[model samples]
Target: MTAIPSAELHTPDELLANASAMYASGDPKLFRGAILESITALEAFVQRTVFRSLEGRLDPLLVKWLEEKTRMDFDSRLSVLTQVATGLPINKSSELWDGYKKAKEIRNKVVHSGRKVTAMDVELVMASVRDWLSYLGTTVELEAVLLTLKRWVEQSPKPPIENEAQAIQLVAQYFHQSAAARITIEAEINTGGRRHRADMILDFGPRKVLVETKFPRLANNVRNVIRDAVEQADAKRQAANIGQACVIAFLRKRPEGVSDVVERHKGGGILSIAIETH
Candidate 1:
């Protein structure tokens, strides 16, 4: 996934790096930015993750509701999201969540109480934030990644990809670079003693997702493309150790936003999504 290293803003990876640099510099003044960026980056990532991973799956009313909650408390966001979003909520009483809340308080003190932070504060916050990332990556992050790619067609930097290969390239690049996840393109899988190639594979630590992409200009093509990908996924699912696999379809807008996101499922438990791009 892309780490977002460009100059405009810092991604969590960049913010964490800045925190480390500031701590290494031994400049007490810089520690505050480090501390602030560290916490802010975590907050930013949570919102970004939620939107990119789950927005397309939501009803329009829920989309508006989430927009209104842009400034909602993080815990409240998590609480409400658990009601609507997939994946089990991180336990509030667990050490991981509790430690993160404690770290968040330190961040709040810096902003509201004008508290001066030292290197030790930076260390504590950094460790806790890193732990949070690790926990998410190893646990429920697979669901998050799969959910994100279910709307893979929406992530296209350029709309109207010309063919299946181009569509695969676009989403694969987006996930491999932006999601901070590992991916393999044109990966080979064996089924029924014969070998076939799947569009892509995504890795979230121990878990994985088999991805097949489709670009359908006509509405009728939607079902056919989805069926084709499901067959492919079913073939590779057993061979690849993937419990879940998905097909992402980018539909051209001749009718111009004629449809929102349409999802389909096969008996083999494969999911397919069609997102219109205008």
Candidate 2:
């Protein structure tokens, strides 16, 4: 297959368009590879734009511009980009930083390792591409606005107030939005037995669900975590009149022991949920 010509005058929107086209081409392998390439290109563009914009004085107009153009909360949005773009050793941030790390890993396997890229992989890569493009568009637009603001600040006679409120508000909103159910972590059990802190607790009305997260990379660890969670849940239930209680062994990746574990625990209330995070 002939390679598509590299996009010239690279822009976030253009990169996104190319990705969409590649995804629509009906070939899973090609689509996945193209999406990865598009992400790489988009990240490079954002880094360049951000560095160039930062050369001049910071100004409030930049914040206004971001709000007006992207409809994102000014402080929160800028902080996210800055953290990923600056203070990081990599010129291009990690794929995980942009939430595409998992997609990139799958793409690498499909493209270089002769692994078959599934339709689900293509769909996921396409979604990641879209998110990358959206982030790029917002960042690029902010850079342009920042440049304008810098010029205005340099020439203006009056000094502007330092708007740290935007930064504070941004952090607060981020924590609020990403907030998860609080699960206590400890090293001992109430029964004077040694135990690991609860990894996660899911409250379901009359039933309480407990989960221990484990990486599939370690088979024994995964089994142990699941077993421990189940045992803990069982113990907790024995002391109280709880309804529909179960311990979940959660794996972020598929493990080889999954089948054996499931078979052994068949008809038991123990469950497993496969999750992947980027």
The candidate maximizing TM-score is 1
For candidate 1, write residues 186-265 as lDDT tens digits: 88888778988888877655456687887876775666666777777877888877766777777674233333433434
lDDT per residue for candidate 2 within 1-278, as digits (tens), equals 12212112233445556666766787775766665666565455554555344333245476446435543332333345443333222224655345566666776687688777666776677666556544443334323332333233334444322332332232123222212222233222344354434443433232343433343345457666666656666565344433223332323344665432111132233443332221
C-alpha lDDT of residue 37 in model 2: 65
Task: Report how far off residue 49 is in candidate 2 (Å).
Answer: 2.1
TM-score for each of the candidates = 0.62, 0.34
Model 1 lDDT at residue 46: 62
Who wins the lDDT comparison? 1
Model 1 has how many clashing residue pairs? 7
Error of 1 at 63 (Å): 3.6
| Model 2 per-residue lDDT at 267 | 29
